[model samples]
Target: MGLVERTSSRCAGRAKAFKSPGAWHAAGFLAEADLSANAIERARRAAPAYIDLTSSNPTHQGLIFPVEMLRAAAEPYWFARRYEPDARGLLAAREAISRYYSGRTPALLVPPDQIVITASTSEAYGLLFTLLADPGDNFLAPNVAYPLFEHLAAAHHVTLRSYQLDESCGWQIDEATLLRAADARTRGVLIVSPHNPTGMIVQQPIAALERLGLPVICDEVFAEFTYRAPHTPPLAALHPALPVFTLNGISKMFALPDLKLGWIAMNVPAASAFGARLEILNDIYLGANSLTQAMLPALFEHGLAFTAAMRQRIRASLDAALAVLKGCPALQVRPPDGGYYLFPRVMCQDDEEALVLKLLERGVLVHPGFFYGCEDGTHIMISCLSAPEVLVRGLELIVETLTT
Candidate 1:
């Protein structure tokens, strides 16, 4: 008691000197952020009955699941309480993923040894960032794609250089723009097929990726949800000569976001070298859970019906929303090539942020263009994954708000 009291008494005098506690180097990114978007705040406080055009989650959009099949798949974890851990995930789960790819439209034959599992695609991105780049290195990413890569790069102390996806050319990658943006410090390239918000698949000739000789990370989470364009082959499968890491997950693939399972399929012949280092990194974190890994094989084998049903709903909602938006002359609706989003450009002088707030005030919510690095004029992104009736009502509200 005497010793503890003396230590507390000495430290209490110096406690007044503590002003800024967030001294961690990695957390500096959070401190520099400008999160003063009133649109987001208003949307958060909107009434519970407000129509959400921004609903990206499939589980809440009224889709049936094979409950018994999922329950049966998870039963093994209870009986076989084996706590065996592998950095690359369970052998059976890896084999199941390999088989799932090998049976793809054109067949992408991936070896189990070349696969690394993670809790989510977000974690998979962290692993790839660590594997490919040093702190000062940069990666080239599509300018009009999802804003997530920016945050991920910041967290790892890596820079993300913007390469334009020309909207005039159907969101195709402008190779000249990419070359201009990249420098010697560039370590890799990220290509998101069925790009978020833009909805353009990377269908352009990418021989330049092999020429640049940097590793390519492709995100094909929305590959199967294609509607306007034909399903492009997996980037890793198409460019086997290059070091390609393809990321996909149960979240979008099986509409099981709650179950948290994702994978990195490395397609380089020299993957063994990368695999060894990756195993050590994964072992340090060991983020993948055993129950989900145990259930993957069954999910892959029996979950296609659920996926098909979800895709059907997405198409139906998309078609209905597009039909309604077409009648609104104040907007230009470019039907998404794929994915469950409809990113229509709102033709008005109003700032996109103001428009979003106005929409929120009218009991509807949508994202502004600049939120995804789009510097162009007013564009609001709406998701087609919502229930059809809700999507139609949201589209009507948008039309009414903008036309007035």
Candidate 2:
């Protein structure tokens, strides 16, 4: 027999009689699995119909793109002529990234040496998680942050503890709460600026959080798209005194998630030991794509115009969505300072999953607030990057449902 089979056979006797409930094993261990499987099966069988507000992809959501620009983006690189970046990514690509950042915040002064491009922000997270914490060490995250980090943290064996982001103040992380969350085991803090789902910049609080003696992993993928305030300086610029691993990618910046281009720029004080250790970790992985790195110089120079126009289109859609949502008094939107999303709390005691299922039944796909680690109440996250007509129609339907 296989190891599992043999172990199961050996443990089948009378141990349960002597064991505490927690210490019970063998067939009883398998009993929990059986019960869980049955519960999941029953829930699936009993699922309610719904219109989902969970769609995020602009491409799939019927947004128009410059077809010619897209066609050109796919013209394959001359692989024979292309090769790996110098372990730190190509200098030209880094220069292009520097130019991109410099154009927005001249005061930020992003150095080419500080940037290490990855294929996606997810990879950047994996890299930074491994760099900042040993297995079993902790990173503090915003309570209602994106849920992807749970899987990312698991892969690196890093524990993530949630700190409340005050929803009363449009869901910005309260500085005091963050400071309380930090301890000797806390190696880093991850904040999503123009945060995912909630879409608000933690402007005033970011500085205070930085004062705590831990590295910061700021995900600013949505920096280019904001609905309020003159765009705050990217967090990389905000705290050069502390170690900051700032991540952004072509996915959100250029609306080019297909290109698989993301990067992490190390903005820690150059003298810090963390800075040296991260470089060694980056050198070991060398995870960047060379051809995409090669594409950066021309894309940043030319693509900035495309991105600027896209930003305008998204803002128009955001305005349209807010207006529609405002008409529905039962649903209140949390105004976003920057980002391609909005979080709207609706008048429903029913869990977000139930509400999302209700919407999905109406042929709308939306993300429920609970999906974003929200525990307190029901909410829905809708993408502002959708085509304007769909945004309008979706909100009308939402209003109709809320009123009736």
Candidate 3:
């Protein structure tokens, strides 16, 4: 039978779980019971505009890139464009990624042949899921992570086992929990340095990861936004013996998400064993477009100053938000090491959904902590990736609402 026929046959018995005539793999995501999402929609439709404290998109947050610079970068590609396809993406783009990594603090020297390009980080996750796990096999991912993994795992027909990140210990990985989450079927471990929503960088998990003897998938999309640490080291640089797949992109690095380019930089051993297979998988789709690949070199060369300025703006916003939130007696917040989010514990008896809804009624919107797998307490996620004045005002409203 053909691939489609085989997939249809596999999903034949699972029709009841699906809302439509779609693959059984995506049945769980067909519908979801999210009270906070519903409340946000209703609140937006009502009177009195709301302040969005959970805004993270750089484009929407008033961080504009230089149009002339972007134009200049793409202008050359328009005139000199030729359709040359490589299974691993454009050679020049991969070389540019290698050069960018070489400029990091620890300076990881990645070879162009070891890198595989994808359209976006989301697509990179999908590709990695295919590369690492079979239908029934699983990968270990951190708890309190962005929800993207769950969706990606579902689409790929794999399971994601959760490992704990101890909030009391600055959200560091609990070594014991991590080991316990692994089993014979475990294919790899996913690590998000400078974690989303909480902003905790992976400081000391290399030794523990070595014990597991599994490949590491490090997501470093927010690597450049470090606030507390002197600099965030590439996990690949820290561990030479282990097979590390470092994922990053221009989306967060240069706020160019629309351009659609992300990549996986494989360590030496990983490339030696699995590079051929990954190249085959990437060749089937060749998902990344040619225009962005041509512009990547220029983006890295001219975009550093812009990214540095953007980081300073985010730091100022974070500082302002922390200062205002500190005055609230009913909330307890710890400063994050990196990234643009603040996860603060609500020192109240209100339920997570109720608290989010209450804040929404008061005209400010913040994500409930449960959205990011926070189960220990009632927490709310606040993004400082907004305009300085807007972030401060939104935080002030959160304080007033909780205190009253």
Candidate 4:
């Protein structure tokens, strides 16, 4: 049997065996492998310290939070503690998000009613997958995207098809690859501006996708952290006629991942049809807590200083990493336009996973290319979100491994 058939049969067997509560796992995503973490844990127990090049959490990387401001923002929720759940979200929070979008180019005037708040962008993806597709319908995404999409689609019983991102063209969307991947069962197309790992801003062919009549789901969580070029413009602004759902959150935007808040800015004529149904979906879990919703306005306004500091830190880290890697001839590094990752192609004969394990043994932890669905060659992604000293040390170890 083919992959789909095999996966379906396996899912059927699993469903029968467990009296299947949800069968979300049997949807045939990658196994929940913790091999990288396992390797890192073993190395750490045996050694004094390991320079983790895969560090993406901003809070752990030494970002100072405005504790007073954040505390004050959430204080109001406690004063008026009552369950006033609006299936869409608190209007005030949505209004705050709308105001945030009002500052975008072309002035994306997203009404508070059009916004659907969720616990995280990952939740937003689940909502969208269910809203746009029936089971067995698929969405096309970039081959080099973050792995979360695979899990999200699998959870919703949706298949994810990956189109190519032309690495030769600064990882722009490969239209031919995309066209070949889609069919009548394709429900939507997912794009990530300042894409994770590769940090490539999507210059989507809006006119072509408009013809395909598929809604465009653009994840712009890292839209603000540009170095080589201007920040990526809102994908919704570029193509107003096309059905667009722009996903962003306080996670990457304000370095507040633990805040657990995200929203979808809907910008299309057909969005109205989705509103009531989307509200029903949001109501099912009501995953977003009112405390963060209460804090969002102040967080958005006051968190600028924190985000500014982080952007500076990431840029500096990238420059420092590039400077060190310049001396290492075996690895090729392309500085990303945005995002906190540096994915470098490694010149090594060993399998990527084995190389990752070897690097772990050498007291540095980094992600192998295959971890992010990279099949082109031996590549590994390191985070530029680490502290400068830690990042420099990690890169030095990586260089030693590559050259030796």
Candidate 5:
């Protein structure tokens, strides 16, 4: 069966268990076999070390932020420490985030009161899931998407309906498939602009989304890294009538994932109605640390230049990798509209698992498309976040193996 069918079957099974009082357990924690990871680990113990082309961690990719600047940003927090906490995060942090949104291309005015801070985007997802969905309610997500949504949904006892993203049409949302997937139980629609792995941005207007009348949860972590598109308009800015919750953080923006700070900016007057309940939920955990909240304003003040430099470096690496990969006749690659990942279709007849293993044997590691729910065709995901030389070398190895 396909990814959507499999997901539906699994969700149906999970929902049935929810009806029984004795069936309560950590079902989401169940692990499945990952053949590619096992093979890669085995390969690592042998002669040649594998060059990872799937590294997304900015710190590991030599994209470190200035330590002195970080220290200076947090210096004031050290001297004037207080334990006062607000459920919607610090006012200064929220105001800074408001300013950040207001300064975007088609500026969005997100009031500080409409923003709720979380420890990270993942945590924000968890909170939103709880806020929007009940035990058996569902949400719509793209078929070719990062697997985190599945896990988060499973954890909250919620189902995620799959919607197709047409690769032939530049990975745009298949509106028919999307509409068909939603039923009475679907509480929200999850949209990832500059989507992970595939890097397809939702540039067109979302008229189909308006018809559903459900809330929109947009992930914009890579909003600053658009390539073909001049800028990624915040989904909130595109449709003011639709209730949209925009999620972003400094992790991808400023290359500071370790700092662990993210937020949800609620748009539209209707979305703001949930702010009180959201505040109550946030107050329960108070997941965001006070120190990071204190440091946020300074980071925003001094980090724009750093983010611009990082975007340029990523663009250079992407261009170089694409130029080399396109030379290999066995691979059909397309330039992403944004972000630093290249999802190339493998024209070779080899099975996806076998192809990945073959690449690993030749000292390069990459992810198969199936890992990200791309079951329509055989594809591989490559990250261009590495240094230009390292990325080019890895791409050359992949090309050599596939062509041979």
Candidate 6:
């Protein structure tokens, strides 16, 4: 067999053995940063260490929260007394979201009907997936964006294809590339605002997707954590006629992921047929973890302040990471638009796996860019919110390894 065929044939057997797309064969897995998983697991086996630079998790790294405040947010919900909010969500929680969005985009109110509460955005995506695309239909997405959608798509049994996001333009969407990526089989286009890892946002790429007459699934979980632009309204506001499913949750927004609260808001103002289907899907799932939904009103009013504080801390962390990158000649970090991580190319002798493995040995853990669907593996991602001191030290060790 030829080299390419031989490589594929060889890798195919190994690929089938992995649980789901993991670092090994990377076949069936979903979106996860196994860096910590790799570190903690391998550390027990080996115990070489330094600091971890790869984590976006709020709790483990300690983002500095008011424990009492978080406790109080869930307190009222505990008194539940058997009150469920129409399986849609409580009016009080919805109104708080409405008020927040209204302030963010005063020109319009997203009409709380547009929002359906879920236990998490993952559920929101699943709802949208079930509502629009059938099993095996293809979804077009950015070539270099978050990997979580891949896992979700796999679970939903939807095929995913990619269009390029121009790396040179601060990761802007390429309208032509998107057009080329979609066909009749394509059910939807998914976009992550201030995308994960790369941290860039697709500010001006939807016009093409709209032309195709396909629905758009916008994951705005990181919508509130922007750096360059003022918060943009959910895509529903831009093209009211287009069928759009906007997903967001408290996981990243408020840094209260432990709360297990999330939501899917359907914005198909122009397509009532599509809206009806989505509503039914929500009904099928009912509501996720009632107590978490119960905590929403309190979270909106009180926990939000903690989120604002976390954003400030994230900015500081981003600046520190950028500053460190300046000194590391072998590394180049692309400025992210609004997420909590930076994806940069690490100077590697071959692939980043060695560097990643080396970093783990040193106690500093991080994810290789290959984990996020980059065709090439020169990239490594570092969480922008890894505590200030730890991030600095981690960067120092990473730079040290690259140069030496």
Maximum-TM-score candidate: 5
lDDT to native, each model: 0.79, 0.70, 0.83, 0.79, 0.84, 0.70
- Give all candidate RMSDs, comma-separated: 8.7, 7.7, 5.9, 5.3, 3.9, 6.2
* Higher-ranked by TM-score: 4 or 6: 4
Pairs of colliding residues, candidate 4: none
Candidate 4 lDDT, tens digit per residue, 1-404? 11211221111221112233356763343443221334334444577668878767788888757789888888888889998888888898999999989986447888998999999998999999999999888899888766677667767878888789877787778888888888889999999988888988754445657667788899999987887756678888888887889999988888888989999889855476577788898999999998999889888788878888888888998899999999998887888888889888887545776787788888898877665767788888899988999999988998898788
Which sections of candidate 2 miss by over 4 Å?
A: 1-52, 62-84, 205-207, 268-272
> Model 6, poorest ten-residue lDDT window?
1-10
Which regions of candidate 6 are displaced past 4 Å? 1-45, 78-80, 105-108, 268-271, 347-349
Q: What total of clashing residue pairs does each candidate reach?
A: 0, 20, 0, 0, 0, 9
Residue 307 displacement (Å), model 6: 1.1
Clashing pairs in 1: none
Question: What TM-score would each prediction reach against the true structure?
Answer: 0.90, 0.84, 0.91, 0.89, 0.92, 0.85
| Error at 339, model 3, angstroms | 0.4
Against the true structure, candidate 6 has what lDDT? 0.70
Clashes of 3: 0
lDDT tens digits by residue: candidate 6, 1-404: 11111111101111122255547555434333232333233442465446767666788778755878768877876666585545567667767676767766524465677667787887888777777788778888888755566667767878777888776677788889999988778998888886887887655436886788788888888887877666655666776677777778888887877777777666545236575666677777675676777667777788778888888888898888888888887886777778888888766456555667777776677776665666554788788788899998888888787777
Q: Evaluated with lDDT, which candidate comes out highest?
A: 5
Looking at model 5, which ten-residue stretch has the lowest summed lDDT? 2-11
Q: What C-alpha lDDT, on a 0 to 100 scale, does residue 231 get in candidate 1?
A: 76
Using TM-score as the measure, name the better of candidate 2 and candidate 6.
6
Report how far off residue 41 is in candidate 4 (Å): 6.9
- Candidate 3: RMSD to truth: 5.9
